[model samples]
Target: MSYALTLEEMTPALRVLRLIAAECAHLPAPFVHLTPIEPERLELSLHDVDLTGDTFNVFELWREALGIDPDQVTFRVQGNGRTRVLRATGPYGGADVTLTAYADAPAAVTTTTGGAA
Candidate 1:
Protein backbone atom coordinates (compact mmCIF):
# COMPACT_ATOMS: atom_id res chain seq x y z
CA MET A 1 0.00 0.00 0.00
CA SER A 2 1.09 3.58 -0.66
CA TYR A 3 2.11 5.27 2.60
CA ALA A 4 3.95 8.30 3.83
CA LEU A 5 5.63 6.44 6.69
CA THR A 6 7.82 3.62 5.52
CA LEU A 7 7.22 0.10 6.78
CA GLU A 8 10.10 0.57 9.20
CA GLU A 9 8.49 3.57 10.88
CA MET A 10 5.00 2.17 10.72
CA THR A 11 5.95 -1.25 12.09
CA PRO A 12 6.60 -0.23 15.68
CA ALA A 13 3.52 1.97 15.84
CA LEU A 14 1.36 -0.77 14.38
CA ARG A 15 2.75 -3.23 16.88
CA VAL A 16 1.93 -0.81 19.68
CA LEU A 17 -1.64 -0.69 18.47
CA ARG A 18 -1.79 -4.48 18.15
CA LEU A 19 -0.45 -4.85 21.64
CA ILE A 20 -3.10 -2.48 22.88
CA ALA A 21 -5.68 -4.53 21.02
CA ALA A 22 -4.37 -7.69 22.63
CA GLU A 23 -4.50 -6.11 26.06
CA CYS A 24 -8.07 -5.11 25.34
CA ALA A 25 -9.06 -8.50 23.91
CA HIS A 26 -11.09 -9.45 26.95
CA LEU A 27 -13.00 -6.21 26.71
CA PRO A 28 -16.48 -6.66 25.29
CA ALA A 29 -15.97 -3.35 23.54
CA PRO A 30 -14.87 -3.79 19.93
CA PHE A 31 -13.49 -0.37 19.08
CA VAL A 32 -10.72 2.16 19.66
CA HIS A 33 -11.13 5.91 19.79
CA LEU A 34 -8.64 7.94 17.73
CA THR A 35 -8.58 11.46 19.07
CA PRO A 36 -6.17 13.98 17.68
CA ILE A 37 -4.04 15.48 20.40
CA GLU A 38 -1.84 17.79 18.38
CA PRO A 39 -0.95 18.21 14.69
CA GLU A 40 -0.22 14.54 13.95
CA ARG A 41 -0.53 12.87 17.32
CA LEU A 42 -3.61 10.81 18.15
CA GLU A 43 -4.72 8.97 21.23
CA LEU A 44 -6.37 5.55 20.85
CA SER A 45 -8.65 4.52 23.65
CA LEU A 46 -11.00 1.61 24.08
CA HIS A 47 -14.31 1.75 25.88
CA ASP A 48 -12.50 2.12 29.19
CA VAL A 49 -9.24 3.11 27.54
CA ASP A 50 -7.56 5.74 29.63
CA LEU A 51 -6.52 8.80 27.64
CA THR A 52 -2.77 8.92 27.99
CA GLY A 53 -0.10 11.15 26.50
CA ASP A 54 1.05 8.51 24.04
CA THR A 55 -0.30 9.22 20.56
CA PHE A 56 0.13 8.19 16.91
CA ASN A 57 -1.50 9.06 13.63
CA VAL A 58 -4.37 6.69 12.83
CA PHE A 59 -3.82 6.48 9.05
CA GLU A 60 -0.14 5.60 9.25
CA LEU A 61 -0.85 2.80 11.70
CA TRP A 62 -3.58 1.28 9.55
CA ARG A 63 -1.65 1.32 6.27
CA GLU A 64 1.13 -0.74 7.80
CA ALA A 65 -1.15 -3.11 9.69
CA LEU A 66 -3.50 -3.84 6.82
CA GLY A 67 -0.87 -3.73 4.05
CA ILE A 68 -3.23 -2.40 1.41
CA ASP A 69 -4.37 0.76 -0.27
CA PRO A 70 -7.34 1.64 1.87
CA ASP A 71 -10.13 3.72 0.45
CA GLN A 72 -10.71 4.84 3.98
CA VAL A 73 -10.81 3.63 7.55
CA THR A 74 -14.11 4.06 9.34
CA PHE A 75 -14.30 4.84 13.06
CA ARG A 76 -17.58 4.20 14.82
CA VAL A 77 -19.17 3.04 18.06
CA GLN A 78 -22.05 0.62 18.40
CA GLY A 79 -24.25 0.30 21.47
CA ASN A 80 -26.57 -2.58 22.19
CA GLY A 81 -28.07 -3.66 25.45
CA ARG A 82 -25.44 -2.56 28.01
CA THR A 83 -22.53 -2.66 25.61
CA ARG A 84 -20.93 0.36 23.99
CA VAL A 85 -17.55 0.44 22.27
CA LEU A 86 -15.30 2.36 19.85
CA ARG A 87 -13.74 0.57 16.87
CA ALA A 88 -11.84 0.96 13.58
CA THR A 89 -11.77 -0.95 10.28
CA GLY A 90 -10.39 -0.65 6.77
CA PRO A 91 -9.75 -2.54 3.57
CA TYR A 92 -6.57 -4.54 3.71
CA GLY A 93 -5.13 -6.89 1.13
CA GLY A 94 -8.27 -8.45 -0.32
CA ALA A 95 -10.43 -8.46 2.79
CA ASP A 96 -11.69 -5.73 5.06
CA VAL A 97 -11.02 -5.41 8.76
CA THR A 98 -14.51 -5.05 10.09
CA LEU A 99 -15.04 -4.13 13.71
CA THR A 100 -18.55 -4.49 14.99
CA ALA A 101 -20.49 -5.29 18.19
CA TYR A 102 -23.36 -7.71 17.87
CA ALA A 103 -24.45 -11.32 18.26
CA ASP A 104 -21.85 -11.89 15.58
CA ALA A 105 -18.75 -9.72 15.87
CA PRO A 106 -15.83 -8.94 13.57
CA ALA A 107 -12.23 -7.81 14.15
CA ALA A 108 -11.51 -4.14 14.91
CA VAL A 109 -12.23 0.13 13.94
CA THR A 110 -11.36 4.36 13.81
CA THR A 111 -11.71 7.44 11.48
CA THR A 112 -9.42 9.17 8.94
CA THR A 113 -10.24 10.98 5.71
CA GLY A 114 -7.46 11.56 3.18
CA GLY A 115 -5.02 9.90 0.87
CA ALA A 116 -1.90 8.17 2.12
CA ALA A 117 0.36 10.64 3.78
Candidate 2:
Protein backbone atom coordinates (compact mmCIF):
# COMPACT_ATOMS: atom_id res chain seq x y z
CA MET A 1 0.00 0.00 0.00
CA SER A 2 1.24 3.50 -0.94
CA TYR A 3 0.57 6.24 1.54
CA ALA A 4 0.52 9.90 0.61
CA LEU A 5 3.01 12.12 2.34
CA THR A 6 3.08 15.94 2.48
CA LEU A 7 5.93 18.04 3.77
CA GLU A 8 7.09 21.61 3.84
CA GLU A 9 9.86 23.29 5.84
CA MET A 10 8.65 25.62 8.62
CA THR A 11 9.89 29.21 8.62
CA PRO A 12 11.16 30.80 11.82
CA ALA A 13 8.04 32.92 12.28
CA LEU A 14 5.80 29.93 11.64
CA ARG A 15 7.75 27.92 14.18
CA VAL A 16 7.25 30.68 16.72
CA LEU A 17 3.54 30.81 15.87
CA ARG A 18 3.32 27.10 16.58
CA LEU A 19 5.04 27.61 19.93
CA ILE A 20 2.66 30.44 20.83
CA ALA A 21 -0.35 28.31 19.93
CA ALA A 22 0.96 25.55 22.14
CA GLU A 23 1.36 27.95 25.05
CA CYS A 24 -2.21 29.26 24.56
CA ALA A 25 -3.72 25.98 25.68
CA HIS A 26 -4.95 27.75 28.81
CA LEU A 27 -6.57 30.63 26.91
CA PRO A 28 -10.23 31.09 25.92
CA ALA A 29 -10.20 31.09 22.12
CA PRO A 30 -8.04 29.11 19.76
CA PHE A 31 -7.11 30.36 16.29
CA VAL A 32 -9.76 33.08 16.04
CA HIS A 33 -8.63 35.24 13.11
CA LEU A 34 -5.64 35.40 10.77
CA THR A 35 -5.28 37.89 7.91
CA PRO A 36 -2.43 37.99 5.44
CA ILE A 37 -1.46 41.62 4.88
CA GLU A 38 -0.09 41.14 1.38
CA PRO A 39 3.61 40.84 0.48
CA GLU A 40 4.88 39.93 3.98
CA ARG A 41 2.66 40.72 6.94
CA LEU A 42 0.08 38.91 9.07
CA GLU A 43 -2.61 40.22 11.41
CA LEU A 44 -3.95 37.93 14.09
CA SER A 45 -7.09 39.36 15.69
CA LEU A 46 -8.62 37.66 18.69
CA HIS A 47 -11.92 38.68 20.34
CA ASP A 48 -13.48 38.31 23.81
CA VAL A 49 -10.02 38.22 25.32
CA ASP A 50 -8.97 39.73 28.59
CA LEU A 51 -7.99 43.23 27.44
CA THR A 52 -7.25 44.87 30.81
CA GLY A 53 -6.46 42.11 33.22
CA ASP A 54 -2.77 41.26 33.57
CA THR A 55 -3.52 37.73 34.66
CA PHE A 56 -3.90 36.53 31.05
CA ASN A 57 -2.41 39.20 28.86
CA VAL A 58 -1.58 37.00 25.89
CA PHE A 59 -0.57 39.86 23.64
CA GLU A 60 2.17 41.17 25.92
CA LEU A 61 3.33 37.66 26.66
CA TRP A 62 3.52 37.01 22.93
CA ARG A 63 5.44 40.25 22.46
CA GLU A 64 7.97 39.16 25.04
CA ALA A 65 8.28 35.73 23.44
CA LEU A 66 8.72 37.32 20.00
CA GLY A 67 11.48 39.60 21.31
CA ILE A 68 9.49 42.78 20.69
CA ASP A 69 10.20 45.73 22.98
CA PRO A 70 7.34 47.29 25.00
CA ASP A 71 7.93 50.80 23.61
CA GLN A 72 7.78 49.54 20.04
CA VAL A 73 4.20 48.42 20.63
CA THR A 74 1.49 50.75 19.30
CA PHE A 75 -1.57 50.66 21.55
CA ARG A 76 -4.76 51.37 19.60
CA VAL A 77 -8.34 51.28 20.83
CA GLN A 78 -10.90 51.99 18.14
CA GLY A 79 -14.66 51.33 17.70
CA ASN A 80 -17.37 51.88 20.29
CA GLY A 81 -18.43 49.70 23.21
CA ARG A 82 -16.63 46.78 21.68
CA THR A 83 -13.19 48.30 21.49
CA ARG A 84 -10.78 47.11 18.81
CA VAL A 85 -7.58 46.82 20.78
CA LEU A 86 -4.41 46.37 18.74
CA ARG A 87 -1.00 46.88 20.30
CA ALA A 88 1.44 44.18 19.29
CA THR A 89 3.03 44.77 15.90
CA GLY A 90 6.71 44.17 15.19
CA PRO A 91 9.26 42.29 13.12
CA TYR A 92 9.43 38.65 14.12
CA GLY A 93 11.71 36.42 12.12
CA GLY A 94 10.33 36.48 8.54
CA ALA A 95 6.96 38.14 9.17
CA ASP A 96 5.56 41.54 10.08
CA VAL A 97 3.17 40.65 12.89
CA THR A 98 0.22 42.24 14.70
CA LEU A 99 -1.22 39.88 17.26
CA THR A 100 -4.05 41.64 19.10
CA ALA A 101 -6.74 40.60 21.54
CA TYR A 102 -10.11 42.29 21.86
CA ALA A 103 -12.41 42.41 24.87
CA ASP A 104 -15.40 41.95 22.55
CA ALA A 105 -16.00 40.95 18.94
CA PRO A 106 -13.57 42.38 16.37
CA ALA A 107 -14.01 43.11 12.70
CA ALA A 108 -11.28 42.52 10.14
CA VAL A 109 -9.29 45.76 9.80
CA THR A 110 -9.30 45.61 5.98
CA THR A 111 -10.65 43.76 2.99
CA THR A 112 -9.38 42.37 -0.35
CA THR A 113 -9.97 45.56 -2.39
CA GLY A 114 -8.85 47.42 0.76
CA GLY A 115 -11.50 49.05 2.96
CA ALA A 116 -15.08 47.83 2.76
CA ALA A 117 -14.59 46.62 6.30
Candidate 3:
Protein backbone atom coordinates (compact mmCIF):
# COMPACT_ATOMS: atom_id res chain seq x y z
CA MET A 1 0.00 0.00 0.00
CA SER A 2 1.33 3.44 -0.90
CA TYR A 3 -0.63 5.39 1.70
CA ALA A 4 -1.93 5.06 5.23
CA LEU A 5 -4.30 7.08 7.37
CA THR A 6 -2.78 8.35 10.61
CA LEU A 7 -4.51 10.08 13.50
CA GLU A 8 -3.94 10.69 17.18
CA GLU A 9 -6.35 9.07 19.62
CA MET A 10 -8.81 11.92 19.86
CA THR A 11 -12.57 12.33 19.83
CA PRO A 12 -13.77 12.21 16.26
CA ALA A 13 -16.99 13.68 14.93
CA LEU A 14 -20.06 12.93 17.07
CA ARG A 15 -18.00 10.48 19.13
CA VAL A 16 -18.85 7.96 16.40
CA LEU A 17 -15.34 6.55 16.46
CA ARG A 18 -15.25 6.40 20.25
CA LEU A 19 -18.53 4.56 20.20
CA ILE A 20 -17.00 1.89 18.01
CA ALA A 21 -13.89 1.81 20.16
CA ALA A 22 -15.89 1.16 23.28
CA GLU A 23 -17.87 -1.49 21.49
CA CYS A 24 -14.74 -3.35 20.45
CA ALA A 25 -12.94 -3.13 23.77
CA HIS A 26 -12.93 -6.89 24.00
CA LEU A 27 -10.64 -7.24 21.02
CA PRO A 28 -6.93 -6.48 21.16
CA ALA A 29 -5.86 -2.86 20.66
CA PRO A 30 -7.26 -1.48 17.40
CA PHE A 31 -6.36 1.76 15.65
CA VAL A 32 -9.35 3.84 14.59
CA HIS A 33 -9.38 6.79 12.21
CA LEU A 34 -11.86 9.28 10.77
CA THR A 35 -11.15 11.86 8.09
CA PRO A 36 -11.62 15.29 9.56
CA ILE A 37 -13.01 16.61 6.26
CA GLU A 38 -15.15 13.57 5.55
CA PRO A 39 -16.31 12.17 8.85
CA GLU A 40 -18.85 9.82 7.36
CA ARG A 41 -16.31 7.25 6.28
CA LEU A 42 -15.02 5.64 9.47
CA GLU A 43 -12.31 3.02 9.16
CA LEU A 44 -10.41 0.55 11.31
CA SER A 45 -7.36 -0.53 9.36
CA LEU A 46 -5.04 -3.29 10.59
CA HIS A 47 -1.88 -3.24 8.53
CA ASP A 48 1.33 -3.08 10.61
CA VAL A 49 -0.40 -3.93 13.85
CA ASP A 50 0.56 -7.10 15.66
CA LEU A 51 -2.55 -8.96 16.72
CA THR A 52 -0.37 -11.85 18.20
CA GLY A 53 -2.44 -14.27 16.14
CA ASP A 54 -4.08 -14.61 12.77
CA THR A 55 -4.73 -11.15 11.32
CA PHE A 56 -7.92 -12.17 9.58
CA ASN A 57 -9.24 -13.16 13.01
CA VAL A 58 -10.15 -9.48 13.39
CA PHE A 59 -12.85 -10.02 10.77
CA GLU A 60 -14.50 -12.60 12.92
CA LEU A 61 -14.05 -10.54 16.05
CA TRP A 62 -15.47 -7.44 14.37
CA ARG A 63 -18.42 -9.35 12.97
CA GLU A 64 -19.35 -10.40 16.48
CA ALA A 65 -18.73 -6.95 17.94
CA LEU A 66 -20.72 -5.12 15.28
CA GLY A 67 -23.35 -7.81 15.06
CA ILE A 68 -22.55 -8.40 11.39
CA ASP A 69 -23.55 -11.63 9.74
CA PRO A 70 -20.67 -13.80 8.56
CA ASP A 71 -22.04 -14.33 5.04
CA GLN A 72 -22.40 -10.63 4.33
CA VAL A 73 -18.68 -9.78 4.17
CA THR A 74 -16.99 -9.16 0.80
CA PHE A 75 -13.64 -10.75 0.02
CA ARG A 76 -11.28 -9.69 -2.79
CA VAL A 77 -7.77 -10.21 -4.05
CA GLN A 78 -5.17 -7.48 -3.50
CA GLY A 79 -1.85 -8.08 -5.28
CA ASN A 80 -0.21 -11.34 -4.17
CA GLY A 81 -2.26 -11.41 -0.96
CA ARG A 82 -5.94 -10.78 -0.15
CA THR A 83 -8.19 -8.33 1.64
CA ARG A 84 -11.47 -8.64 3.51
CA VAL A 85 -13.75 -5.61 3.71
CA LEU A 86 -16.95 -5.29 5.65
CA ARG A 87 -19.01 -2.23 4.99
CA ALA A 88 -21.63 -1.36 7.55
CA THR A 89 -23.99 1.53 8.25
CA GLY A 90 -25.32 2.84 11.51
CA PRO A 91 -24.95 2.35 15.20
CA TYR A 92 -25.49 6.05 14.66
CA GLY A 93 -26.33 8.34 11.76
CA GLY A 94 -23.81 9.80 9.30
CA ALA A 95 -21.36 6.99 9.88
CA ASP A 96 -20.21 4.66 7.11
CA VAL A 97 -18.23 1.93 8.80
CA THR A 98 -15.50 0.02 6.98
CA LEU A 99 -13.22 -2.68 8.39
CA THR A 100 -10.22 -3.85 6.38
CA ALA A 101 -7.96 -6.71 7.47
CA TYR A 102 -4.80 -7.97 5.81
CA ALA A 103 -1.64 -9.84 6.72
CA ASP A 104 1.83 -8.31 7.07
CA ALA A 105 3.81 -7.19 4.03
CA PRO A 106 6.19 -9.80 2.68
CA ALA A 107 9.84 -9.35 3.62
CA ALA A 108 12.06 -7.50 1.16
CA VAL A 109 14.11 -9.58 -1.24
CA THR A 110 17.77 -8.71 -1.77
CA THR A 111 19.16 -8.48 -5.33
CA THR A 112 22.76 -8.59 -6.59
CA THR A 113 24.06 -6.89 -9.78
CA GLY A 114 27.04 -8.48 -11.54
CA GLY A 115 27.00 -8.79 -15.33
CA ALA A 116 27.50 -5.83 -17.73
CA ALA A 117 26.55 -5.85 -21.41
Top candidate on lDDT is: 3
**Model 3 Cα lDDT, one tens digit per residue, 1-117:** 322434532234446667766776777655676665554567776553544746667666765676656566766556555343334332342466666666654455867799863
TM-score of each: 0.26, 0.50, 0.57
State, as a TM-score between 0 and 1, how close model 3 is to the true structure: 0.57
**Candidates' C-alpha lDDT:** 0.38, 0.55, 0.58
* Candidate 1 residue spans exceeding 4 A from truth: 1-3, 30-42, 46-117
lDDT of 1 by residue, 17-84 (tens): 56646654443333543222221222343332223311223333433444434444343434533343
Cα RMSD of all models vs. native, in order, equals 18.5, 11.8, 9.2
Cα misplacement distance, residue 62 of candidate 1 (Å): 21
Q: Report lDDT (Cα) of residue 45, candidate 3.
A: 62
Model 2 C-alpha lDDT per residue in residues 3-98, reported as the tens digit of each score:
232222324446446655686556545343332323245556655455454322666666676676788766555666446464667776576666
Q: Pick the candidate with the highest TM-score.
A: 3
Model 3: colliding residue pairs: none
Q: Global CA lDDT of candidate 3, please?
A: 0.58
lDDT of 3 at 73: 70
Better of 1 and 2 by lDDT: 2
